[model samples]
Each structure stands twice: as structure tokens, then as C-alpha cells.
Target: MKKMVYASLLFIFFSTLFSLADTTVLKPSKEEEIRDTIVVHGMVLHGRVTGIGPQRLSFKLRYSDGTNRIAYKDIDSIYTKYNYRISFKRMDIEGRIVGIEENKQYLKILEGNHERTVKIADIDNFIMAVSEDDSFENVVRNKFPYTKGSIHAGLEVENGINRKNTADVRLNLKRKVAEHETRFFLNYNFETTQTADEPKVQNKDELIAAATYKNYFENEQFFFASLAAEYDRPRQIQQRWLPSVGYGYKFTFDKAFWLEPAVGLAYATTQYTDIQYQDDQFTAAALRLSGEYLMDDVIYINTLIIDGNIMYYPSLTAAEEDWIMRSNLGFSIPLFDFLSVKFIIDYTNDSNPDPEVGNNKTTSSLLFGFDF
Candidate 1:
């Protein structure tokens, strides 16, 4: 009897130890397998969300090539791996998010064995609760080359009393990964006009490409580099290049607004189409101011967005009259999900200009575009 009792006790002890070991090993493996799932455009994807914009969400996809962004309104649904703390106008709920449903009007959550549904309009915001090992910063740091961009285009043609054709295209792109951020810009325009009896004349032909890069630090300070290339047949400029390097500080008033002001050294060179005007090169002190304001909700007709920048280059090596300035302002309203309607104005001033051309030029356009 004593031997049997001892055998039973040893069996229970070893069984408990094995059970504990199994639990320990299984917990971490389950967590590691968890992945967020997103449905957009009838395609399902597994990924980690790196960041959120006012209009889009940046995702680092698994079993895919690289990071890209999708507009929130275009997302069919989202299933999260971790628990989320959802904040409403009056209360908060903690649960594992099942998905957004009912055309994005409601969010479904799983709380233990029970499920709950909440209206999205009544909810203010929600955020995932990440574990220490899977912090938000760590997720973003691992996803390099997260990018978003848009293309805007416009075309117009007229016939009958007058014949005219115009085409305009603009591209804006931004990328942020880890501590580095970059922006790219391009614009092209072409127009030809003719009266009933007059010959066809080229009214405008222009192209511009610009890029900027920044490396951020912990203190909201950054070092930046910029380059721009441009040509305009109407203005008699064959080619122009501007390059600059600067330091800047970013000021954030809120999630919806921020500003950056910078000062740097710049070098510019220009070649004119007219042989009478000589090619020129000069150096300058570059000054730049840029900012953005994005509405969280529909403050106006739609979520209004305003962004603009100004750059001034005052000559240091050339004559005082060789200074240059460029400025642009844009106002946009979101349409159907990822689409936007924008009105943009661009201005340029050059103290030294080609013969028969004015010192200042301004252009404006209305454009329709979609984000990608």
C-alpha cells in the first residue's frame, strides 16, 4: 500500500510540471503567429500598421514586397492581432477587434466569449495595445521605405471660334521610415492657342522637378538637403538647377498642424535659350518656410487641407539683383475615399530674368487627383 501511494504522488507531480511547460511554450508561439489582416479592393493582406495619416494608413505588408498606404475610406475591413482600447464620446471599451462592418459604420469586437458592436460615429478613436516586445516604434523602425503619393492631372480643349489645348500634370510623393523623411515633386504643363485666322502659337511649355530629404533627431531638429531642376520655353530658360543644404526645427502644435522653418546655403545655375543672355551661376543664403493644416473632421464641406511652402534665395556671390524666390499654396478637399479636388497657386520671382520676360510669374490650376 505504501508503494502504490508513493507512485501516485510522483505521477501527479510530473504531470503538473509537464502541463506548465507546455503552457509556457505555447503562449509565445501563438502570439508570434498573430498578424493583422486588412481587406481593401477585394484583396486580403496580412501586415503590421506602421503609421496613420489623416486620410491614409501606412502598412508594412507580410509576404509582400514593401510598405504602402491605403485610404481609410477604401478599406473594406480590418482585423487586429492585439487588443485595442476604443474610446467613444462617452465611454471606452477594451477588446480584441474583430473588424469594421456594415459599410464601416460599426466596429465589431470580441470580449472574451462575448461580442459587442459599436457605432463608429459615436467613437472618437481607438488604438492597439502593443506588448513591450512589439512596440509601435519597433514596428515602424523595421519597415523601411514606407511611402505615399498622389498624381494630379487636368486637360482642356476648345474649338469653334478659337482653338486651344492645354495639359497639366503634377505629382507629389512622400516617404518616411525610421529617422529619415523625403519628398518629391514634379509638374509639367503644355498649352497651344490659336484664333480663327491667326497661326497656332505655343503659349506655355514648362517642367519642374524637386526633391528634399531630411534626417530627424530626438529633439525635433533635422538636417536637410534639397534640389530642384526646371525649364520653361516661354520664359526662355533652357535649364536651371538649385541645390541647398540646411538645418530646421519642427514645431508641432497639435496632431493636425505643424511648421518647419529652415535656413541654408544654396547654389543656383541657369542657362538661357537666347544667345544674347549669358548663362549664369551664383550662390545665396536659402530661406524656407513650410507648414500644413489638416482638419480631423469635416470642418467645412469636407475635411479641408492646406499646405504650402516658400523659398527665398538671396544672392551672396552675385549682384544683389540676382536673388530668386519661389512659393506655392494648395487647398484641397477630400472626395469619395482616396480622391481629392485641389486648387493650387504657384509663384516665382527672379531679379534677373531673360529678355522680354517679366521678373515675376504666377500660375494657378484646379486639379483632381487620387492618392496611392
Candidate 2:
């Protein structure tokens, strides 16, 4: 029976579908056999989802060489676990029912463009947004690349009585394919301070850049790899590099709010330029809690956004002073079409610092810049 089903699926899809170019999927690191059956143009097919959009569905058969599109007009029914779409109408249909609307007199099931009006309570079967396909190149080429939340950049500067004169800049970018996403971030900051007791002034510079890649599964579970490099002058750190791999889970409360908990193992190396502690290298584990919240035109005038990042490392042995902590909080608002204001607090704590330096460092900046 299994052989017969597999053969029928092969015959149905291979005879009609065409290969999608500029798309490639990585072979799975672990073998977990699975398939989905799609009903289109009176033909039944078994395959995996490659991409999905407002009106178009795409897939490829099991053991097939390439993926192809399932024109919305030709599709009769869809059955999958991840990206399910149910047909509901005066004709008939229903689902697990995660939502409902009292005023609008309708319910929203499925995500994206495939939603339909129940003229009455109805449902057919199911369709899915995607299946277990993890190919970075394919995702970057397909519908995933052009979706929402791909790029952001900003800068901030400040001079005040309570804080030193300072400047900070940050940039973030991401590329995605289906459930997989890759992100890059760059940050640089400089500060000058003049204290009443100290005769001379002091200045510091910090530069950090990082790259991370993640693969997502159901229930917001994901696995990831990261690489980062940094330079901190006050701590007499000439250069530092860290490479890590780990996993994380995302929490979505609504369209504008979400949080992620992440953990990773890292190998770190640091070179000190001016301080007594010359060079240090070690291995440590990393933990992170990150979240974002956005409010559109709050107070009926300006949009408001807030984001935060916190990271921690704990000591594991008697010989290692590995405890470390870092956190960042930012608030941004747009005043006009091409202008904005931002405030940020950045803090770091290291268990071990050069004897000439303090164990804690804090920077606060309020800046204005042009938006793109």
C-alpha cells in the first residue's frame, strides 16, 4: 500500500510541474520521512511546501528534483501540517477554531492571504504555509525574501551634565527563506568625559559586529549559529572574537509584540592593548533574553518603539571568573517624514577587568537623525 501511494504521487506531480530556478535546499542533517498530499486540477500529489504567499502556493513531490507552483485557480484542496488552509463557504467547511469575531460576524483561521468568508459557519479540510524544508538559498530566492522586517538602521548622540559627551550608531539586516533567517548587526560608539576631580579628560571607543543564522520549526522553536567581533578601549581590550551555536524560542503576544529566549556556547578570545592584562582567551556559555514592542502613532501623533537585549554568562569552575552580563534598552520616535529622535541605555559588567579599570561601564545617549 505504501509503495502504491508513493508511486501514484510521483506520477501525478512529475508529469506536470516545472523546476524553480535560483532555488536550492540543503540536505537534512537528520532523516525524518514526511510528505503532504495536494489536490489540484483533479490530480492528487504528495510533496513538501517550498513557499507560500497571498494567492500562490508552491511545492515539490517527495523524491523529486525541484519545486513548482500550484496556481491558485487550479488548486482544489490542500492538506499539510504547517501551512494549512481550509475551505469554508455556503458550500461547506471548519477548523480547530483559534479565533472568532463578534462585531465583524466572521472568524480568522490560517495566516496570510488565503482567508475566506463563511457566508455561514463552514470549513473544508486544511492547507499549510510550509513544511519541513530548510534551504537558506531557496528561502532567499523565493517569497520569503521580500516579506516584512528585513532592514533597519539608526544613530544617536548626546552631551549632558549627568552623562559624558557620546555618540552611537547601529545597523541591522536580515535575509530569510521560509523558516530559516540570517541576521547581521554592526555597532560603534565613542564617549568623552571630564570630571571635577580629574585634571585631564578620558575618552573610550567600542566597536562590535555580529552575524547569526536561525532555522525555525513549529511552536517557535529554532536552532542557530553566531559569529561576533568587538573592540573595547577602556578595558584595554584591543580585539575580541566569539563564535557560538545554540537554540532559541520566540513568544508572540500579538502583531506588534514578541520576545525570544536564547542560549549558546561560545569560544572567546581577547587582546588587551594598554592595560596590564595583556591577552585572555577562554570558553564560556551565553544566555540571552530579547524583546521588541511597537506602538503606532501613540498619543495620536508619533509612533513609538522600544526594544531590549540582556545577556549573561555564569562561572562553571573554581579557576574561572566567567560571570559576565550586558544589557541594552532603546526608545525611538519619529518627529517627521525624514527625522527622528532616540534614547538608549547600554550597560556591561565583567567579573574580571584590568586593575586600572572599573568592573562596570554605562553609557546613555539621546540623539536625533534622519530616517530612510
Best by TM-score: 1
Q: Evaluate model 2: give its TM-score.
A: 0.54
lDDT (Cα, 0-100) at 15 in candidate 2 = 57
Q: What TM-score would each prediction reach against the true structure?
A: 0.65, 0.54
Q: Can you write out model 1's per-residue Cα lDDT over 108-181, one digit (the tens) per residue?
A: 88866788887654444444544423676434422322456789988999998799999989999886644678
> Model 1: residues >4 Å from true position, as ranges?
1-51, 54-145
Write the residue-wise lDDT of candidate 2 on 74-125 in tens digits: 6666655344334432222222222334432343444443554442122222
Task: List per-prediction Cα lDDT, in the order shown.
Answer: 0.78, 0.61
For each candidate, C-alpha RMSD in Å?
15.5, 19.2
lDDT of 1 at 74: 78
Give the least accurate 10-residue stretch of model 2, judged by summed lDDT: 89-98
Worst 10 residues of 1 by lDDT: 137-146
